[model samples]
Target: MKNAQKPDHMSLNSLVNRLKDGRYVIPDFQREFEWSPKDIQELVKSIFRDYYIGSLLLWKGKTENFDALSCEGIYGHQQNGGAEYIVLDGQQRLTAMYYAFHAPEIRLPNRANRAFYFINVDEFMRENFDDAFEYHYQSKRLQRLLDSPKAQYESHQFPLSVIGTGGWDLLKWVQGYTKFWEEYPNTEDDNEDHISAEQAEVYAVNGEQFGQYIKEITDEYQISYIELDQQLGIDKVCDIFTQVNSRGIRLDVFDLMNAMLKPKGIQLKQMYRDVMPNVDWVDTDRMNVYVLQVMSIVLQSYCSPKYLYFLLPGQLKPIRHSDGRREQEILVQSTDEFRDLWDKSVSSLVRSIEILKHPNEYGAISPKYLPYASILPVFAALESHIWTLPALERLDGTRKMKHWYWAAVFTNRYSGSVESTAARDHQDVQEWIADDDARPALLMEFENRMRNLDLSREVNTSSSTYTGIFNLLVLQGARDWISGVAPQFDDLDDHHIVPEAWSKKHLPGNTWHTILNRTPLTADTNRNVIRDRLPNQYLPEMFESSGEESMRSILASHFISSAAIEILMRRDFGPNDFEEFINERQRTITDAIQDLLIHERLDLSPRLRELDLDIERVELALRELVATNLEDDSERIPSGVRQKVQQRFEVAAKKDPSLDPENSRQMSSLLPHFDIRDIQDTLTNKILWPVFSSSFTSKSDLDLKFSQLASLRNGIRHSREVDDVTRMEGEASVLWFDKILTK
Candidate 1:
């Protein structure tokens, strides 16, 4: 690194002249132009008020290296100097100033077109200022006001383009004002003419003051810059750029990478742009970051979140070679090696994207639902091996890859510590491919991680987890509830089954927004037909119009089983029956999630069944233990324990169809009948723990065992999968009780 020059203040006029003469260059490593109209307006206002706008950092580089820029219109006559100054910091501020003064019109990020104008201070102060002397002059808002039909063009509102071009002087401005008065003259109304004369008198008296302010803004306002010597390297320059921009959006790692590769005659941006159009499913603007991330991962096994400087030529080396040259640590010496790495990395990225789009694989139709973008690099790392192989030869590997991907999705393995998880998984998956014994272990690890994930829990529509599963369901041919047509992801709106208005009035708090009640539909169907109506009312009408086949299709699309639909068909629209309907539908959704996440996995199914059988045996043992121990003191249960037992009993009692003769038989058959004695008969170890003999020495230890058993029993009875840790604890508790019974 070379020593930087001392900071110096330069006038705004001189800076603008440098910009116009193409003396200032913006390097390709700089971020794209992103300043909005509001940003520009505020910057102009600050400069007008003579506020300090901070310093700029510039690198004095050779003219040949400054051929490309992130944006245009900063070019004019090139100076005959030996070296030019390239802007490394303050690009946005300089770009805004240059466009405001020189360009004919500038387009904003929101696609709004605007032109800059000098403020009419005298007229504005005379007509709008109060006694306090504070005035508001928002540039864009004021420009819109002046452009309106009812507003007259003021004499002082000169276009900035003409002012910076040396075409307008004070004498010419005065002549233009006189010509304007001659053209429009005065209205016949005495009051209007009197007001016009008052405005004219104020402008005439303060004309010199207005000219002086304009001169001060255009010529005298100073902008400070810290200039770096031309001898500095790209690495040092990138470091300075990143350090100075710590407060705002810092430079992307890809930006630094692009600069490092420029000397080799390779452009990272153009390479990505050329490959982007080939992948039609990707939204280029949104997924560009992921693509760059995948490239980094393919080149190096790990991606550092902060920087990619380590991947440059002198920093990294190939560990091994195809020629068995393991003794030598070979640096990336030639452009050939760089070009080969780029091609392989991009090929891996394209393959990963294709795999995501495969309907039978992850079924990721879009990037909208990608919960962890960090996982994409893992895919790239795995897919890089199959790049040279044909598609048919890679089938088995792809299948194994998809299993891992789905396991990651359901288990949320990449959720909290994303970068570290991606790195670990990348190395693990690579090692598994090399060693045959590691494959089965990897699959088992995936199964264990996924065992306890409760997909039945309600999720909001905007949640990434919910969206991921929803997209997968749609890709499996889920149809719209109204039209029975496969709905497009972008076109679908999340529709509430039992409309929110009626649910709030009848059901529990916000129960209508749960995953079970929400499904996708076309915007027209959601807004026009399903607006604020009960399911019983609209569903019956839909059935009548669309017939049974269509109605069943709609129900199935939302993962509602035929049995649940039958119960819904017979239910009444009365006040208290909606909760029962939601419960039945929720069970149906749980079953669908099980099938989607663990479809046709024979090993997982048998393990789940065996786990459930063990839980049932533990529940029976607990009941026997409670009946034997608590027979003499059944009525002495603690208040807290009794309250929990009563809550469970009340819930079961409400679903007893005998209480409501109008309820469906299917719902009644699914629910258990509970009486006061039933609660007393099956005493959980949690409630009767103190009554146990001194053989169970530690109450805390026994409490943990009973808690695990209770959780396992509830999950088994309610058709949920038990997690591995809870299962192990419950099994150990059952064994301890069994030994006591045998003794």
Candidate 2:
């Protein structure tokens, strides 16, 4: 306090102007710009969510101090105005804001491409934080979209670059967007590019709403900063800067909340300290914040940072009634109530951690290999809620919780928007537990995601899917080849099945590092038995020692098929043989994942299974028929159909770059991109109808069979509970397709 003035605040609008005016400078000794694109996106999301982004520490510097420190303007800073303050802290936050708002044509640190940020209006309106903010590298496609007014209106993206110039630029862009959409409603021709008057009005309204909201946030949001007096001696300033940088600690939300609770006599810091040791087994530094998150979830069924503030003892929390009415309710009206809730939340967190660590439950083994630590708050809150249910109901709730947990992990649901995801999952899973029919959308999402699951691409040890697969193997009681028993929790290690040493020599790149090629084994077994040798070299030895049946059983526990073992043990084992083994193992893993996702009570009957198989065969037959008939001439396909399929492939390529149309595995045909709906489009195309007319009775008949098959395929794909009558209809349609396509 001797050298620094009290913390003061300014509007975010003023902050941006001051930054552009080059009033604040970074000292040469400060760390370089280090925020990645993801970090920048999160900062933007925080700002829009109205969460505090931390205060800055700046030294009011004299000319001599500036010269001595060798300070310079922030990166991409254009104005040469003399520096008024030398920033000691918050450099990364300030620079990220400048880069995003300024939209400088420069690459991010350690990145090859220049980053561009945009707010997706649709996602923002829907409150989907995960997709609300987006960043993309500068590309021709991006440029074309940005240049086209129609495209921008259709995509509902508001570029953040206009913010740095001034609010006027944004206003003008919004006006232009609204006018363009209004003028081009396309009533004359109802084509793909046309929109109805109703849609045009909606777009116009959204554009104005987006602009006004951004302007309000920019103009009203306050940024706090502490200013050190220039009168302070140079040594004192230098010492202060070093101390601030070296400590690497900031007062986060938990710190602020702790102080807020003190006036209410809650002593949150003391409560957290008492509870921390119990949850110390959870390997994360943000345990304090997680505790608050758990409390938020339990109280309001929401734990986002903004929602956490509602946990204050006297806060008037809004409650919506089942009859479409809302009212204010004091969530924690007294200190005693707050303490009771806190104690119960801590107890629930302990129970959740125990369940996670237990081998038979989630099989996370330890906090070290837990797929997603971020999901703990929701998991704990749900556990607390479930404990309040009747004994018989509690058992059912726990089983469903296990299924939801795996679905969340395999879908990577908590990768971003952790708080929002937590709130939604808590609510959805609770509903699902109470009602058998109220299956959460996440289950269907998981099924769709698993249908596309390719384990060979899961290379990172920290990824949810990668760790999830390992946990699945652990839950399977993966017995070590050497001991023929499950390894101790600490002794278990994920070792490469094909041997990293051999794969490094025979395969290209990091293909050997995939989760498909790795499984749980004892560390001792990895070092002593499967040491740097090919599977063929060592597996045969294991088979002889353990007997073929015992070896197959052990491998089955690892999600390794017997067929894969046979391929690995072939006398002529080579890279191709290795490929076959990996493909088969990937299938085995996929099947296990599918099995885990199925509801125990809603198990598919044999008729439903046959319908699924028949649907797959029909897909393959269509692909072969298209390839044989069209000679793989993609250009001959209808422009609309080709474009739609191309869009699907492009979106798919984001998840797996190998899903390109050029990829040979799709059989050089467009059929792979064709869902049952898309298949209908292709079959009904006027240009291509002649080729298909010979196989089908007529276009109407083709439509009837497809409508039935598509409905049934969707039911299977989405895991919707089906009646016997609907199943019969689906089977009849599948038989019809088999009869027609086989001809």
lDDT values for all models: 0.58, 0.80
Model 1 worst lDDT run, 10 consecutive residues: 127-136
**How many clashes in each candidate?**
0, 0
**lDDT value, candidate 2, whole model:** 0.80
Candidate 2's C-alpha runs over 4 A off are: 1-8, 27-33, 56-71, 82-89, 139-151, 180-201, 225-246, 262-270, 315-329, 601-743
Candidate 1 residue lDDT tens string, 1-743? 54567688898778766676666666777776787655655566557656567678888776444553332233222344533778888888887777666653445555545545454555433432111112133476666644642232343564444445653543465445444443443455634444455555555555555556667776888999998877777678778877877667745556667777788687877877787775545543524455555545665665544323444555554357788876534335566765666666667777777767654455565566554555766788778764544654454454455556666765556654355456656676665545432443334544454444444455655454566566556655667667778666577777877677876777666666776667777887888887887666677788898997888877776777776565555656643455556667656654544554443231235555565556555555544555466553434444554455445444433433233332312222212322223333234345455566444666666556666656665544332456788777767766765665456
TM-score, candidate 1, is 0.45
- Give one digit per residue, the lDDT tens place, for model 2 in 285-371: 888888888999988898877888888888997778899899998888877887888888888889999988877667788676798
* Model 1 score (lDDT): 0.58
Task: Identify the runs in model 1 with alpha carbons over 4 angstroms from their true place.
Answer: 1-248, 276-289, 305-310, 313-315, 318-328, 331-333, 354-360, 387-393, 431-458, 507-509, 566-586, 599-743
